[model samples]
Target chain A: MKKNILEISSFSNEKLKYISGLKEKKNREKSGTFFIEGFREIQRAQISGKVKFEYILTCPDCYLGENEEDLVSSIDAKTILVPKQIFEKISYRDRPDGLIATAELPDFSLSSKTKLSDDPILVIEGVEKPGNLGTILRTAEGAGFHKVFVADPRLDLFNPNVIRSSTGTLFTLDVFQSDIKELYPILKNAGYKTFAVTPEAKSLHWDADLKGKVALVFGSEQYGLSEYARSQSDQYISLPMKGVADSLNLAMSAGILMYEVLRQKSQIDN
Target chain B: MKKNILEISSFSNEKLKYISGLKEKKNREKSGTFFIEGFREIQRAQISGKVKFEYILTCPDCYLGENEEDLVSSIDAKTILVPKQIFEKISYRDRPDGLIATAELPDFSLSSKTKLSDDPILVIEGVEKPGNLGTILRTAEGAGFHKVFVADPRLDLFNPNVIRSSTGTLFTLDVFQSDIKELYPILKNAGYKTFAVTPEAKSLHWDADLKGKVALVFGSEQYGLSEYARSQSDQYISLPMKGVADSLNLAMSAGILMYEVLRQKSQIDN
Candidate 1:
């Protein structure tokens, strides 16, 4: 396949500006697109076959895989070539992997037949940190969760940091963007118990029946689970903290809770 | 109690340079001190009473405490009166809380008779990310682990990000640093069934006997557990990934494993 490498010399280049604007949640939603950078992340996106690649931009020396080429051909996106220096300027990290791909948001709908087994679901509410969100997605995937529904996510789901932090797991997971009101009904209808994780909760997390089809709810680090979300939850559960710390990080809580679900499921299966 | 407010107007302030340098691990070790910023974190340090506070710098308008005069009189440290602008410059976060305290590193050594439960211990190896390290500490503390030991930590425990991420639990928990080789004797002596968490591991995480006195080891995100660490382990355990993503983040894995330990213990306890 013949490739056209377009050198992005100016930061004012329309494409560069568009990609840069994606760092903001508003811009990503406005364009109905998000940017996923780095060679590894782009490769994961391609392998997942969920996101539609608008274009793949990389330095002259970078290799584009056959799958990537097929994706480019299928989407009719011109593989824009970027100078190394220009790519560095647009990259998020200190060292640019020399690859960035603009991808259309995957069309995701919460499955009506969402399986609620002994394994619990992880529900995130208003998670602000991109890295925390990404880490949670990666953890959920590792803990055997098939779906992660973001209820009123404060940051853009496709933020480059989120992509990098998730180690590209975000590309493969079922990530739904909706308000708690929208998600609560679906979870309830699916017969999934919702447990809101909070410091003020009287019951310890271990005391909760995590073996059931459950959705573990967490909020931002600052305000914790929102009052509305907390009120809507089936129960409030907390980790047993003997130390001086008040609460765990959003991702850590999700990881602990998801694994609890897995542990319970394994015991049941045995 | 008369409080002296030191207003640091110049960037050339030696104290400012010293505090900023604490951001690096080398500088922190060389100086034998680290800075904890923000009101809540500083309060946590005071409550834990693990680390000695060398000094407290804050704006007059900032709430020191209800008995501000009494609290200031109690500590034998010089109080610096800084303008909000000056504090903002020294602060790491965007909104400076007008409080930064220099703290001596706490002696985090485990006691000879440190209680070892039938549950597992988390040994974090070469985790570079402060947030990841902090999250792991928070989870370990929350999950009621016998103890958490940092095996070749890449980032200093006193890094502001680690302090913030752990919600100041770093000060209260039994967190000590050691190389991977040092853990083998300790595990053997303590009768811990050693398990290394790695993607290459054939045994699933659930397959391990987490209810026993197990020591679960994890490495950096960039590099999986060192070959030596892997070789020393009795068994290798990995989370079952149903998706295309190959690995989970280090902290997330730690959190999940910690909870698994908690789940097993809870089951046995009940």
Candidate 2:
């Protein structure tokens, strides 16, 4: 590991202010950086080659864990040692393991991920909840979907809550943010069929043909797919709701659809 | 509407203290009551008959909304109008809709719900996250599963987070907490087949016959089903994971499986 060039205590108000400001999307955008915490998450971000770490901060007292020596040494980023109190102030988790890093946001373009996969692309529109967004990304990566496009995202992908919930899968997945109006033409031009998820849709997802190059579009839990999304969809489908609850959480809905896409692809491959 | 025996101000320290104490599980259990916030949630709890409201606290300045008058008038519980400051102090939500209530925890004995349904029963073992627990309940309800048994729940069902995340679906569903050791015999005696979800399981959930009386068992995300749960299960099944992630979130896994069970049942019905 690089020898620490900076030692920070909780009393360093200037540094604390700058670090805390990263919590907001605008501040992160202005600085072109975001925070990553926990050893596993930081390592995943680094290994993905998407994130460029500016600084890795750790509390020597309780930060390092088993096999973390090699993980720490592999980082080319500047290393800093901070007191436990300073780390706690910047950490988001209830019981933080003390490793935190600030990294430049990944520059993902739809053009870069064009040839990434032949399977369906997951698209989320007007997603408001950061936790839901993060969980969808984690599920997308786990389902082996290479490209996920967030159309009209209410929360930035780099928000600490999103990063934490994705468990660093955010860096591994090829995620791009664009307006649905802008994305619709691109997906159509790329010969993709879009299936919009809505509660009112008569088509059950299982009955609909999910095979081939597809884009599974879902809207925020509060509002089903936006009018623009519905207008562009090749077909409208829904996961059947049988009981009293009106709708499923966005993440669960997206997860079920992504896995269905994966399951269909596996069947074809076999 | 209750013509107010007590009007509370933020400065009423004793009243504030009692309401605030309901935030903790121990306090809720000691006094046998829990907090419910938001007009929609409180209304649902009242209508379900499962949750008994002890008191209804509304901030007159901002509490009443369109149609809320009818909802409020319907509640037979004691009503108290509190100052905005006092309402804000006990409100868990950031945008408090100015409605809060203290409700008696429903006595959800397994015996009371024994005749509830012959449909699949969702069993969650060692669930720790309130959000996950709540979401699963919401999903279980949406999928039309009548009864859910939590075996070794880490968080109490009446925790504010669970109440909030379930979107008050907790009141509508037949939920009970029981030990895994105690629950196995009960399920078996009822002619329900217990299918434990685990990563190492050989059977794919889809291939398994999920037709008649079934109990779908899921464990905490951290640790799969306990040895006791596995031992008591009739068959062990898993949701196919084809990506780098080892497992799905507890809620999502439960949702997919519950829906799968619903799908099979629908197929048989047709």
Candidate 3:
């Protein structure tokens, strides 16, 4: 394991300042780096080999055990030991788990030969909430989708909050940043049917032909799918609402779409 | 509008103490009350008539305008103005939005004919996160699920966090607490298929018959479905996982199952 080097005493430590500033979207973009907190998430990042860690910060009293230390060693990150109070000040959670990592963002790009199976591909547009984006990524990964393309990813994928909300699946999945305008041609050329998930659509999600190579598009909660995204799609589908609530959360909508694809693919495979 | 009665100055105010205590489940249970912050949420609660408020606390500077005051006045809640700092102390969110309502918990009980429709029901077992519960409720409401039977709900229904996460859908849906054992016979007699959602299940979610009246069961992240809940289920179904991740979040799983049912029912209807 990497030996502890720096003893961070203040929140204004250069690294600490950089990490705290990453909580905002602009800072993350400018730095080309982000933070992932908690032991489990950092371990996942280490195992995935996609993240390049600059350093790890931990409390002296509750340092990572040998097994965890071994995992951290493989990633080649510098280690720092800090007081518990210092750790707490930098933590986003109510209880800091005494472990945090600063890692280089994964350089992701969509594959030229996009795999279009019978299962539907999830296309997220302008998803604002980090938790919602992370949950959708976790769901997309779990449902066995080949790719989860973020068409205009609003939040940083490597945000500590996103990593926590995703339960570390963000470390494993294929996530790319692109807009609907750029992605539309690729989807259409691939012969995949595109379905924009919206509330105002006349047909229900089930009515759509989800069994084919499909790209299921979802938009922001405040505004549904953009006009451009909707126009480019082959079909528009919606979840039926029997209650007074106007719309479902973006992540939930994506989850429903992913599962519908799962359901259809399973039937065809069988 | 209800006239502002007290200008809260101290942190030790009885009302502030009560609202702050809601951070713990035990306190909420003992007091039979919880906090609901945000203007839209409080407005929804008032419109639903599910919760009776003891008081509405807000910063005087951020208090509603005369037009907004007219809307608040009709709610019949006792209004109180507090310093922004005092309001911030008791508020869970970073920005309080100048509204926090102390609301008595609704007496939630399963209806005798709890089967609201031939469409599916969602049964969540031992879900620990209020955000997950709220997201599931939002999805259930959007998917046109007849009722959501929260089996062994770990968090209180009136949790301010849940209300916020749900985007006010909690006010418009039928949410109640009951045991899995209590629900089994009723679901069976109603000719509903009870599908326990697990990663180890033999059948994929799509391969299962979700068209009829169905009850999709989900469990906590730490534990899969409870032994009792698993035993009582008619069958177990899983979403296919291609990635290294074993499972999706509880709310995501519920969303997928809910939408799958919607898809099936729509096909049949069409």
Candidate 4:
């Protein structure tokens, strides 16, 4: 251990207050850092090798095994010990495991000229809920989409809730934010076929040709895609609604569409 | 109006306290009543004719349209006008629409001998989250499964969160709660094949026969279908996960499978 151990027992500690400030998107953006919580998510983020940790804080009482010790020692990041009460105060979860970290935001950007594989790319528009955004990211990774562009996201992509709900899959994928207006041309120039998922579409989602360099687009829970997203797409598709519900949740819709893309691609491969 | 307009200006009002107490599952069950929030959900519940409203509380400051007035007038239940501050205390949402209600639990029970359509039936075993339960119910309804049996649910079907998240679809569908052991024999005796969705199952979900009377079974997020559910299923199926995520969200998996059942059945219909 580096012997720079900063003990924080009081809620009045400036560093503790600063760490708590990371909960807001404005603070995170200003600091160019985001927070990650829980054992599984932090471990996954560490293993992904994409996160550049600035600080790791742990409560001594919550330590489980040698594995956690090894994890703490392996990283070059500054490690701090926090009292259990202090940890609880900073935690968003009702029962936290007492491991938390701050890391620089993922180093990536959305550009018109960016190259993509022949596999499908996900484009989510105006996804307001962090939980929904995180679930969509997890589903995207599971369905083998290498890149997802979030257009006009209402929630910060690196919000702690998003990171937690994603099970840290957010670190494992190429997620970029670009407005739909700017993104349309980039996809078009890349020779990608864009499909917008909407309730009003006549083409059933599975019926849409989701093969070979396709872009599957989705929208928010309260509102479907904006006019720009709807009008710019090459094709419009919808999931079948045989009963009373007019739509599925945004994350559910994205997951279904991503898998459909996978299913079609797999069928073609076979 | 019967002019019984009971004013609850104080949060300490016994009835207000009682209404607030319904937030707990035990209290809801003990009182033989549950809470419903917002104008749209309350309206849907009322229009379904399945909900027996005991009281309708509205804040004059939040009333929207002639529709709200019409809806309040149409119900035979006792109506009360609560001050906005008191309404805020009883409201679950931050931005209260100014309408809330208490209603008697729907009169229904699960039995092995209950009638079901020839179409597929959905059985969710031990779903822990109220949100997931609601999403599954909404998806189940959208996919045309007229009835769903939640086997040993962790939360009540009529929980406010479940009711809200389902977009009030709970009132439109036939939902029941029973154990997997009990549900199995009922489906088997009803000439319905039981398909349990599991991560370990080798058979791809799409390749399975989803036609005729089939009970598609799922498990909770924490513990996927119990051992009894696994052992008793007529067939085991899994959604193809092509990348790093070990599994999708419970609701996402359920939604994808439900839609697949619809797609396959629709193909046969065509």
lDDT of the candidates, in the order given:
0.76, 0.82, 0.77, 0.84
Q: Candidate 3 has which clashing residue pairs, if any? A: A206-B263, A263-B206, B1-B73
For model 3, the docking class works out as medium
What DockQ does each listed candidate score?
0.56, 0.70, 0.63, 0.77
Give the poorly placed runs of model 4, Cα more than 4 Å off.
Answer: A1-7, A63-66, B1-7, B64-66
Clashing pairs in 4: none
List all candidate RMSDs to the true structure: 3.7, 2.2, 4.4, 2.2
State the lDDT of candidate 1 residue by residue for A10-100, as single tens digits.
Answer: 7788988888777677888899988888766777787778877776776645444434444444443567766777777777877666677
Using DockQ, rank the candidates from best to worst.
4, 2, 3, 1
lDDT head-to-head 2 vs 3, winner: 2
**Ranking according to TM-score, highest score first:** 4, 2, 1, 3
| Least accurate 10 contiguous residues by lDDT in model 4 chain B | B1-10
lDDT of 2 at B168: 83
Clashing pairs in 2: none
- Tens digit per residue, CA lDDT, model 2, B29-62: 8999889988778877987888777787778676
Q: Chain B alone: TM-score in each candidate?
A: 0.86, 0.93, 0.89, 0.94
Residue-wise lDDT of candidate 2 within A54-143, one digit each (tens)? 887777666557765566678877777778877777788888887878888887655534553566899999999999998888888877
Q: What is the lDDT of residue A109 in candidate 3?
A: 61
Runs of candidate 1 with Cα error greater than 4 angstroms are A8-12, A47-50, A60-76, A105-120, B1-12, B47-50, B60-73, B105-120
Of 2 and 3, the candidate ranking higher by DockQ = 2
